[model samples]
Every structure is written in structure tokens, then in C-alpha cells.
Target chain A: MKLIYRHLGAIKIVALLAFMVFVCLPLVQMTLLAFVATLPHEELEVGQATLQNFSGILTDPNLRAAFGNSIAYVLINICITIPVALPAAYAFSRMSFVGDKSLFLAFIAFRITPPVVLTLPVFQLFSALGIVNSVFGIALAHCLFNLPISIWILQGFISAIPREMDETAFIDGYSRPRFIWSILIPQIRAGIAVAAFFCFMFSWVEVVFARILTTTNGKPISMAINALFGFQTDIGLVMAVTLASMAPGAVLLFAMRNHLSRGFRIGQV
Target chain B: MKTKDNSGWIFVLPAMAVLGLIGLIPLVTVVNYSFFEIFILSSRFWVGLEWYGELVGSARFWQSFARSSLFSMIILLIQIPLGIALALCIPRGRIWIGLSLVVVALPLLVPWNMIPTLWLSLLNPETGLLGRLGVVLGWPLDWKDSAVHTWVVIVMMDVWHWTSLVVILCYSALTTIPAAYYQAAAIDGATPWDVFRFIQLPRLQNVLLMAVLLRFMDSFMIYTEAFPINAGGPAEATLFLAVDLGEEIKAFNYGPSAARSVLYFLIIVTVAWLFTKAQGKLEEKAAP
Candidate 1:
């Protein structure tokens, strides 16, 4: 029994180490490549690493515009998603109304629908509306998916708060909106953080809709990176830009690690 | 807790309106356009089920569909069990738990486009770490020429990209299982397999179902990551349904693309619905 227990411990450690290596190796390789001055195919002198790749990409006018547009659209997406989804999620969690069940399921259906299914139609619609290639338009297009997911996650959080709290607040002469703002919103702060993180992450990373919905006027970083692929450019510069784009999400993850893990338990996202 | 007052509709109206305008309307438009032969932005004539017929009859469509299904299946088989195993190995202590989760989740945060770019760099024969390792192992690592190599790269990339989602979900679920259950198992002298089968697996059913559904849906619609790497290359051996649909859209083949899009939507919804129904039945059986 003692020998068996010792072997099990050894196996667990080995497994964990192997898993860590698998997860980290690719990322570490890419990061190292980003810092190198010369391509690995060219002379990979040990001390030739430089910040030139990062500086060069950051200063490029087109790349800067892409970065700005991506950040603008992602923020807009989160802004639109939160206000709209909060009320809807509250309604779904706290009240029952006609067509509630079916409507909620419709949102799930929308969530599962491939963005490709809606891309052409959305493009045509946006073009007709004269909002194509604008930040707001791309954000609105993203809301088609993000709004539903935000509601889904927010509803889960809202539902977990006891119903009696609402009744008690009502008895204390609080108006519906006031109670929701002052009492309920404070309680689900972690949910909002997680939902916002998810919205930001999804919008920031999404390419298909962003690709189709915007032209040069509002080109996102993903599209810019893709365009770079067309040109025979430096792989190190592309990797550097890619690493730079990952910063916002990495920071968000570290800051909200506790809320996210907790939120996943309650929400099912 | 049911309210007779239907005033909640007012609260939901704004969201519903937005969803209607963006989601429902576009969906309806796609359904409508599936019947039309679009020649230009303004020049379209009603074809009425002709495109659907063509889609159904096309060998290419079926091939892409099968390829998509196979890719999803392969990833599901690998990622699900692998994710569960990784989640199980995560230390239950506080600092290790947080550290492991953050590290595991890092790949998920990388933009989809970058994943392919990153992998491409990492697999370049001359300089890439994987390519160097491949050379040392004396293996043929030509992703551009070999279907098998492309498939392997795609699968490995996907597993690297998404298994973290399953791990996070399962880890969260595992944490919620009370200590008392494990204590009870220990008192009963349960073997590790018996304990897992009786306690952990049973507790994990809901999360596992969720993980399976999300993985299936996302992997089935995989586009951005795989598209950049090879764009379904090596003689189109990796061309998935999304990539196929994307090609039609890129080439401005609106009619057939719309028809194919609707069909793709139905397949996903049907599979998801069926999975949910099956899970419901299993839950009923287990509890009763």
C-alpha cells in the first residue's frame, strides 16, 4: 500500500509537469521568436535579441490605426451589451412574462448560430444602413451574439440572489430601478466583471464578423494581422503584434481570476 | 414566485428589439436570399429551392460537412478526456489552483488569428521549435504537402487552443463537490476507480454535458484559427463547412452560400437539441 501510494504521487507530478510543458511550450516559443532580431532560419546568434520588432510594429501608422479601431469597437460592444443585457437578464431572472421561455431559448439559438450564417446578411444590412466600416456598426453586429451570452450569464447570477431580497426592498419603498441599481447590482458585481471580461474577450478575438463588417475605415488588429500574412513580412514583427494584442486579455485574466472561476461555477459559461 | 403582472415585457423590450433587428432580421434575410440567384448587389432573381437542391446534390458540400464533423469528433475525443485529466491533476490548494488555471487559460486569450500565425512560426522547418524537434525525431513534418500532417497540425492546434475551456469548467465543478462526499468514500474504503465512478463522475455530469455541448458547437463552426494556418490546404483536405461557406461568400456566391448557411444552422440546432434531450433523460434515470 505504501509503495502504491508513493508511485501514485510520482505519477501525478509527472503528469502535471507534462501538461504544463504542453501548454506553455508554444507560447514561450512564440514570445522568444518575437524578441529575436533575426529570423530563426537566419543566424540565430544567442545575444542578437532586440526590441526593434516591437518598436517598428508599434510605430507603423496602419498597425496603430488597426489597434485603435479594435480597442474602440470592443469597448463599444461591451458598452452596448451591458446596458441592454442587464435589464433583460433581470427581467428573465426576476419576472415571468409571455413568451419568456421561448424568447430566452431564441437567444441561445442565436448564440449557437455560426457567425458565417449571418455575415452576408449583416453586411448587406449594414451597407444599406450606411453604417458599414464604422466602429458602432461592427459593435452592433457583435451585439447580435454578445448580448445573448451576457444575458445568459447575468441571468444565472441574478437568479442565485434570493427572491426575498427583492420583496424586502420593495417593502422598504424602493422603486424597481432604484432597488436594482442600489441593492441588486452591488450583489452581482462579480458577475458583471466576468460577463464584461467575456464580452471583451469575444469581441477582441472575433475575426469573421470583424473581417466582413469593416473595410479600411475601421480595420481591426485581427484583419491587419491577416493582411500582413498577404505581404511577405517579418514573422518576428507579426508575432510581436500578436503578443501585444494578447496583453489586455492577460491583464484582465489576472485581475479577475477569482471572480471568473467563481462566476463559471454559477453561470455555466 | 410566479407573477401575474406581465410588465416585465417592457424591461426585456429593448434587448429583444436589438436582437430582432440584428439577429432575427438577418436570419430571415438569409432564409429569403437562399431562394434567389444573386448575380450582383442589385441583380438577383428568385431561384426558389434550386440552390438548396444544388447544395444537397453537391459532393463538395457533403465532403466539407463530413470533414467538419470528423474534425469536431476528433477534437472532442482528445480534448474532453484530456481536459478532465488535466483538471483532476490541478492541486486543490489555493495558490497552485490559481497559478495552474491562469497558465492553462493563457492560450484561450490569444486572438484566433494569432493562434495560426504563432503555430506557423513554431512549425517552420528551419527555425520553429516543433520543426527542430521533428528533425531530431526524423519525422516528415511537411504540413503544406501532406494531408495527414495538416490534419495532425490542425487537431493539435485545436486541442492546444480549446482544452482549457473544458479544464476550467470541470475544475470549477470539481471544486463545488463537498468534502463530505470524499470523506464518506474514504470511510467506505473505496478504491480510486470506485470513488471516481461513484462520486466524482456523478457529480460531474452537469458540467460534462455543458462542456460537451459548448465544445461540439464551437468546434463544428471552427474557422478563424484553421483558416489562417493553411486555409484548408493540402489539396483542400482540411476544408471545413465554415471554410467552404466562407469561400462562397468571398467569391460572392450568395445564393448557394445562403442555402448552405441555413442547412448548417439546422444541423447545429438539431444536434444541440438532441444532446440536451438525451442528457435530460439520463438525469431522470439517474435520479429516479
Candidate 2:
């Protein structure tokens, strides 16, 4: 019986090790392939590693511009999302409004709507305004997708926070705005951070609408990465762009590693 | 819960305004466009039900709808249970939790474009590890040329990317299960399975429903990763509704695309509504 139990423990360990290795395989390959002199065009290889691909992409002006645009767009999205969502979340969490439940669900319903559904109308709308390919145009479009998610997650977080906090602040002579800014904001700092990270990440990585809306100057990194998907593949450039695109999200997650994971766990549930 | 301040309205205005201007306006536009015959974005003629009739009658549109719905169903059927199991395995406490989380989250942080690219290379039949191994072992795996293979690749990629979402959600719900619940169960001589079945599972219902709905909606609208992988190829085997809609929009077939989009939205909204209703029903059943 003891021998059987020991064998079972060994099996579990082996399974865990195998699953870990399997999950990490793509990351390992991507890192190794990025610096490789020549990636296997049709298929990946255990190749000779070098820094040429990364250098090539970084040095290109257009690529740099797109990278910059991605950062700017994400920053704009965060700014727009935080102010808009924080209040809406406060309303949903604190007050009972007419049509509150259904309205909240409606917002989520819109969030769940596929971007493709609105693509042409948005194109026409932007084109009519002569901002079809502009940064602000793309940023507005991003808010359409990201704001509801931000509000939903923030509402969840705010609901989890006790209502007594709000009443306590009110009783202590805090004005509404002051109370929200000074009292409520501090309490939900973690939620705000989580919302901000998600808004940034979604805006940073979105491709479909980004592709349709932005032509040149406002082209984000996902669009830039799309440029790498060619029939005649330049694996080197593709690897370079892929790595460059993922780097920010990767770095941010690494920096706020614990918090980010906690956010995902909380935000999702 | 005061209705008088209207200050709460001020808070909601920006988000509502943005959503209204961009999200809501376009939707209204799409509905309006679906009733017209549009050409070159310049001229349009009112043609009520014409585009809808054309879309509904088109075998291609129906085929793609079927394909997308099936794929989403399959993903949910597989991912939810698998995610719950993975979440169950993860122990509570800060020790080693950080490292484990990093492991789970690494794949999720990879760019959307990168996911398909990673899978494409990983499953490469020549020098790609899965491909090379399959050839050597005789699995005949070729995603680029086979619909079955493409679906498998897409499913695998999705599972890899999103099971983390479910796992993390379930984990959060699991951890919040107070020690007293388990202790009380154990004191009553409940088995591990009994504890999970009676206490843990019920607590997880809301989150699980959310996970399922989120996955359903996301997978139904899947495009970015799937598009780059095969471009909906292999004789349109992997061609889902989004891909079909994308092609239509790309070709500037605005009327038909709008009609199709409406149908797609209706289907998704219906499913989501059904889910919420079901959740409400479950809660009512649990009420004393």
C-alpha cells in the first residue's frame, strides 16, 4: 500500500513537470527563434541564435512609429476608460437607478457584441468626419470595446467593497466629488489598477478594427505585426515584430506580476 | 439610492457617451444600413428585408454560422470542465503561488497575433516540433491543408490561451470558500468529493456561468488568431461567421454584411440572455 502511494506521488510529479514544460514550449521557442539568424521558413527549427531580427525591426522608422502609436493609443484608452468607468461603476455599485439591472446587462450585451457587426457603420461614420485613419478615431473605437469591460470589472470590485466605507465618508463631511476622489478611489486603487491594465492590454493588442480603421500613421503594433504575415515569409522580421509587440504586455505583467494575476482571478469571477 | 442628485448621471455620462457615439451609433447605423442597398459607400436605396432575405437564403452564410456556433460549443464543452479541474489542483497560500501564476499567465500575455503565429510554427509539419513529430510517428497532421487539423489547432490554441481565464476565476471563487465551510463538512465526516459537490461547486456557479458566457461570446466572435492561421482555408472548413462577415465587409458588401451582423448579434444576445435567466433560475432553486 505504501509502495503504491509512493508510485502515485511520483506519477503526479511527472505529470506536473510535463504540463509545465508543455505550456512553456512556445515561449521558449519564440525567444530562441527571435534572435536566430534564419528561422525555418516553413517550419521552426532549433536555429543558431542572433540579435539581427530584433535590431532590424527596432531600427525601422515605420515600425517604430507604429510601436509609438500603440503606446499612445493604449495610454489614451486608459485615460478615457478610467474616468468614464470609475463613476459608472460607482453608480452601479452604490445607487439604484431606474432600469439599473437591465441597463447594466445591456452595457454588457453591447460589450459582448462582435466588432465586425459595427465595422462598416463605424468606417462610414469616421470617414464622414474625415478622421477615418486618425489616432483619435481609433482611440474612440477602442473605448467602445474596452469601457464596458472596465465598468463591469470595477462594479464587481466596488460591490465586493463594503458599503459602510461610503456611508462612513459621507458622515465625516466629505463632499461627493471629494469623497469619490479621496475616499472611494483610495479604497478601490487595486481595482482601478486592474481596470487600467486590462484597458491598456485590450487596446494594445486589438487587431480587427485596428486593421480596418487605421491605414498608415495611426497603425498600431497589431497592424504592424499583421504586416509580417506574408505569403513569402520573412521569418526573421515576423519573429522580430512578434517579440516587439508582446514585450510591453509581458513587461507590465512581470512588474505587477502578483497583482495582475490577482486582478484576473478577481476580475473574471 | 437617490434619484435626485443626478451626479451619478454625471459619472455615467462619459462612458455612456462614448459607447453611445461609437458603439451605439454604429449599431443604429448597421440596422439602418441593413435595410438599404448600398454601393461604393456613396449611394444607397431603401431595400427593406432584401439584404436579410439574401443573407438568410445564402447557403454560405448559414454554413459559416453553423461552423462558428459549433466551434464555440465545442470550446465551452471542453474548456469549462478542464479549467475547473486545473483550478482544483492549485493549492491556496502565497508560497509558490506567484510562480505558478506566472506559469499560467505567460501564454495569456502573448499578443493576439502572436498566438496564431506561435501555434503555426509549433504545429509546423516540417521543422515545427509537432509537425516533425507527427510525421515521424505517422499522425498525418497538416493544419494548413486539412480542416480537421485546422480546427484542432484553433481549439488547442484557444484552450491554451483561455483555460487560464477559467482556472483563475475558479481559483478565486475556491479561495474565498471560508475554512469553516470545509471544516464543518469534515466534522460531519464528509468525503473530499462530498465537500466539493455540496459546498465548492454551488459557490462556483455564478463565476462558472460568467466564464461560460464570456467564452461563448469570445469564441463565437473569434477572428484575429483564426484569421492569420489559415485565413479560413482548407476548403472553408474552419470558416466561421466572423471570417465570413470579415470577407463581406472587406469586399464592401455593406448591406449583406450588416444583415449578417444583425443576425449574429441576435444569436449571441439570445444565448447570453438565456444564460442569465438560467443563472437566476438556479439561484431561485437554491433559495430556502
* Candidate 1: fraction of native contacts reproduced: 0.65
TM-score of chain A of each: 0.89, 0.86
User: Candidate 1 lDDT, tens digit per residue, A204-268?
Assistant: 88888888887768998888877776535677778788889888889998887776665555432
Least lDDT summed over 10 consecutive residues: which range in candidate 1 chain B? B138-147
Enumerate residue pairs that collide in model 1. Answer: none
Each model's lDDT comes to 0.83, 0.77
Fnat of all models, as shown: 0.65, 0.50
TM-scores for every predicted model: 0.93, 0.91
Write the residue-wise lDDT of candidate 2 on A17-131 in tens digits: 5656767777766776677766453344536666767887878887888888888878887888889888898887777666667777778777788887888888888888887
Candidate of highest TM-score:
1
Per-residue lDDT of candidate 2, residues B151-193 (tens digit): 8888988988888778767776777678999889979987656
Q: Return the clash pairs for model 2, or none.
A: A35-A50
Model 1 whole-model lDDT (C-alpha atoms): 0.83
Please give, for every candidate in the order listed, the TM-score of chain B alone compared with the true chain B: 0.93, 0.92
